[model samples]
Target: MQYRKFGKTGETVSALGFGCMRLPILNEKSENIDVKRAEEMLNYAYEHGVTYFDTAYVYHRPMHQGISKGFSENVLGNCFQGAKREKIFYATKLPTFVIQSPDEFEKTLHESLTSLKTDRIDFYLAHSLTKQTWDRMIQMGMLEFLQKAKESGKVRHLGFSFHDELPVFKEIVDSFDWEFAQIQYNYLDIRVQAGTEGLHYAASKNLGMVIMEPLRGGKLAVTPTEEVRNIWKKSQYDRSMAQRGLLFVWDDPAVSVVLSGMSTLDQVKENVRSADSAIAGTLSDFERSLYAEARKAYWNRTVVPCTGCEYCLPCPAGVNIPSNLNIVNELAMFGDVTLSKGNYEFQPPSERSENCVQCGVCLTKCPQHIQIPDHLQKLTEQMK
Candidate 1:
């Protein structure tokens, strides 16, 4: 396995980190983690030199249960016994959305420390910080809290995982002296939340940039359309779709580590093999251009131009406009209604596209000028 200097932190971490959120689960329940299977995968990753293990307080929790569900840390504590725990750099997040008071900060940290059976977290983050959450955290003295965490020896490094506009990301990065940060980056998400500009900005400050969703929540790794497959065939590298996606992110010298939420031992093996070749600035110009072409092929299949900006939200009829449209776009791009329909059904019954009442309230709000109700109606018809 290859290692990279984890920017200004002066620590060397494996190029590939094991993200424990998507561990194998039993009986189709998110919280019902298949412990034996998950342990096997973790052991495989560890044995193969994946020293960075990332989990969160809410990783495997049921969405309906909100932030209260936190079984991931306990599972890790259970799996890594004795000396195995000391060698791994455990990275986890504090559930920023649920903190009701200043006291809750220490309360959550203590709970996480106890759950992980560790005295100090190698890296701790403010989980999934949006602009609203960042504002709330600042008002709650979150920066001081992080400083205290490191000072108290409960956390070695302080950082955040982001999901907001690049300006908001820059604001948070500049607000505190963070050691590292996590952002969603991939070939497809170049211009999305904390895109290339944000990646470089964080790097410019000498902060270690940990990349999450390098596969776009596993969409980029899934079986692609025939157009996308043909484009991959043109690559002389002969890599799998998953490796191609990973390599694109790891190719950047600014990326300190790429986290893959591997659910199976096979995935662990495959990703570890990819890490062997994760040298920075290695992709040829021809290989780099393929990603751009593949992106266009995927975008060409998009039926709705909705950028998921969430401006057309709080649908008067309770429909989740962006989510519904995203499923439609996923179906169009990948031609996988079976998977897309499953995702659509996963949303609350109230948030389903079928709940759209054609209120026309969202009609004027959309930035893309999407015919909101018409598309929701079409989604409802297609699902039927």
Candidate 2:
């Protein structure tokens, strides 16, 4: 496997990190992991040179069914034993949602360490930080907790995984002395949460950057639509859609590692092959253009033509026009209606499409001439 320098640490880690969130499962149950199959996949990946193993306290739990967490850490702990355990870089997170106070920090740390069968964690993160959770963490003395954890030799390095707007991302990065960060990034999500600008800013601070959701949660890895496939055909290099997606993230020199949550042995083998050939700054100008073209092709498939411009904002009915429509566009682009529907639930009740009064005020301001109220009505029905 190819290796890259991990930012200020100057330590060389495998270009590809193994994310333990999506191991194979049985009976359509998230908590009922298929251990034998998962063990084989993990063993193959480790033998092929993937050393960074990332898990979390809440990984492999049934979110809807209310199952207890830590199955992922237990499974991983069972897979590697003897000398293998010390060689691997164990990375896991302190669940942000469960952190109600400063006291919960150490309690949770010991829980994860016990689950992993490890005394010290190699890389620990504040998991899934948003603006609200971040503020709560600070107010509860996160900095002091981290310092104590490090000084006690329980956690070797500190980092965070983000899922918020760029401004909040920048605030979190600047607020702490972080050793690394993980963010959602892909060719299609160039301007999404912690996009290109966030990547460079963290690198500027000498923080090692780990890329999560490099395939946009497996959307970019699937068979492309006809329009996107035609665009990929023009490229001189022959690669699967998934490999192309991964290489796009690995192409950046600033990235320390790209995490892939492999569920099958075939995926482990294929990703290992891709990582072996991953090099920074190798994409030709023309090849890079294909990514941009592919992105546009996906956008073209969206039902709404909203450019996310706020010109139609300040809705008379208090509806958030751009935000609601963007969720529909995300469904079209990624072909994941269930995920898109879940995304809609996060919107404020006052800003939801249900609040649109079918007023014609936004029609005059919209440059695309989209039927604003008509789409809002459709969205309300579809999401329901």
**Winning candidate number (lDDT):** 1
The runs of at least 3 residues in candidate 1 whose Cα sits more than 4 Å from the true structure, single-residue gaps closed, are: none
Question: What is the Å distance of residue 78 in model 2 from its true position?
Answer: 1.0
Where in model 2 is the C-alpha error above 4 Å?
A: 65-68, 304-327, 334-384
Tell me the tens digit of each residue's lDDT in model 1 across 181-250.
Answer: 9999999889889999999999999999999999987888888989999998998877888999999999
| Candidate 2 per-residue C-alpha lDDT over 34-142 given as tens digits, one digit per residue, 9 for 90 to 100 | 9999999999989999989999998988655433565999998888877999788999998888777788899999989998988899899999999999988888988
Residue-level error in angstroms, candidate 1, position 306: 1.8
Clashes of each: 0, 0
**Best prediction by TM-score:** 1
lDDT value, candidate 1, whole model: 0.91
Q: Candidate 1 clashing pairs?
A: none
